[model samples]
Target chain A: TQLLEQSPQFLSIQEGENLTVYCNSSSVFSSLQWYRQEPGEGPVLLVTVVTGGEVKKLKRLTFQFGDARKDSSLHITAAQPGDTGLYLCATVPFNKFYFGSGTKLNVKP
Target chain B: DAGITQSPRHKVTETGTPVTLRCHQTENHRYMYWYRQDPGHGLRLIHYSYGVKDTDKGEVSDGYSVSRSKTEDFLLTLESATSSQTSVYFCAISETGGSYEQYFGPGTRLTVT
Candidate 1:
């Protein structure tokens, strides 16, 4: 079983459209992080939400941590072609970092 | 920007052969990790090191072994390569165990035939 579950395994939308990806789990975590991975490169940290119900905004991207700390969401406003990549949510439980299957986003021009 | 690099960005090895991938970091972070990314599996941990000569097994460490003789270098060795082991391996570093942001290396793509 996957420690984290992400929804909409793949998403393709036209530029300027808005979309949201989700990450959920049955267990509570101290914190959760969101990363974006481009082709042929490693994933890069986008934002980290430590407290429950915390929301962070990074430019056109917004991340929200669930009140129960078992889920999180990433919403993109006015998506652009440059936002095309794999979106992964991660957390550290039991001293090990676990990642979700990831949501592959394709923002078409 | 993480000052981390993986050796032999890409490698192809035959079955039953031993293969070692090296991860070198200039950040001198205390914790280092090795993870393998597959099609449906985002990134599964293989092994991790907390300090020099201090290491522990990850979720998927059955066929892999890690050595961290120094703080700046961590090595992952596959005893006998298997076709199932073909995946892209990534190295990440963090200052602390959890809650801290991790910096990742470019990654090494290994193909076992």
Candidate 2:
């Protein structure tokens, strides 16, 4: 089974701070997706990285896929209260999919 | 929103009781999935359906069953509810051909006491 391990299970920081979350795996993945879920709601897809060593940015969020396709990272800059949520990483391998444990981020005002 | 909706936003049931959750989508997606979310476990796949009547077990499928009789509706059934089964369930949809992008539903919170 392919497993994705996430670090810093929980994080709390003040507004305007920067933080990075990681997702690592021993198996290569065809694609990786990042999602942010708010309380009482389903997760919203933030980005998808398909190629090894790929990097994508969305506003204050940046996502990077390792060259081995077995790891990924999410960096948030100038965090705000709106950025507080549970961030999840999911990897797709053929017909199977695996999700990381998740990182709960709390951005204080 | 993914045009997906899950019925019974919250349910409380006793152990051994049978329960079924319903998922409906307006996107006509060919792939539908069921997942459970726990405090430390972000989300674990319970089951997934590629097409009508074509379903497969996921990482955590024990004691649970699912069916997709129509393109828009997928149903997840718990043969016997257990305390361990108490968690938030989510339904997701994706197009065929391995786009790998899944759109998620609001979610259902089930409590087995």
Candidate 3:
């Protein structure tokens, strides 16, 4: 079983549209991080949320940690073609890192 | 970009052959990790090192072994390559463990035939 579950598994949208991806788990985490992986590249860190109910904005992206610390969400406003990539959510619980299956986003021009 | 590089960015090996992938870093970080990324599985930890010569098994460590004789280098070896082991492997580094942001290497794609 996957420690973290992400949905929808795949998504495609026209440029300027808005979308949100979710990461959910049954266990609480000390911190949650969001990463974006482009084709032929490693995942890159986008944001890290450590506090429950904390929300952080990165340009057009917004990340929020759930109050219970078992969930997190990433929202993209006015998505662009450059935002096309695989979105993964990860956490380091008990000093071990776990990653979600990831949501593949395709923002068409 | 972090000063991390994985050798032979891509490799193809036959079954039953031993293969070793090397991860070199210049960040001087204390923590190094090896992870394999497969379809529908994101990235799963294979092994990790907290300091030179101090390592631990990750969630999926079977058939794999790691050596960290130096702080700047970590190596992952597959005793006998299997087709199921074909996947893109990534190396990551963190200044400290637990909640610290990790910097990832470009990754090495391995194909076992």
Error of 1 at B83 (Å): 0.5
| Model 1: docking quality category | high
Q: Is the docking of candidate 3 incorrect, acceptable, medium or high quality?
A: high
The list of candidate 1 runs beyond 4 A from truth reads: none
lDDT of 2 by residue, A1-109 (tens): 4399998899999999999999998888888999999999998889999999999999999999999999999999999999999999997666666789899999999
Q: Is candidate 1 or candidate 2 better by lDDT?
A: 1
In model 3, which residue pairs have backbone atoms overlapping below 3 Å?
none
What TM-score does prediction 2 earn? Answer: 0.97
Assess the local accuracy of residue A38 in candidate 3 as a C-alpha lDDT between 0 and 100: 99
Worst 10-residue lDDT window, candidate 2 chain B: B95-104
* lDDT for each residue of candidate 3 in B1-113, tens digit (9 for 90 to 100): 89999998999999999999999999999999999999999999999999999999899999999999999999999999999999999999999999888999999999999
Model number with the top DockQ: 3
Pick out the ten consecutive residues of candidate 2 chain A with the lowest summed lDDT.
A90-99
Is 1 or 2 the stronger prediction by TM-score?
1
The best-first sequence of candidates by DockQ reads 3, 1, 2
lDDT (0 to 1) per candidate: 0.96, 0.92, 0.96
In model 3, which runs have C-alpha deviations exceeding 4 angstroms?
Answer: none
Instruction: Give the chain B TM-score for each candidate.
Output: 0.98, 0.96, 0.99
How do the residues B32-112 of candidate 2 rate in per-residue lDDT, one tens digit apiece?
999999987889999999999999889999999999989999999999999999999999999973546788999999999
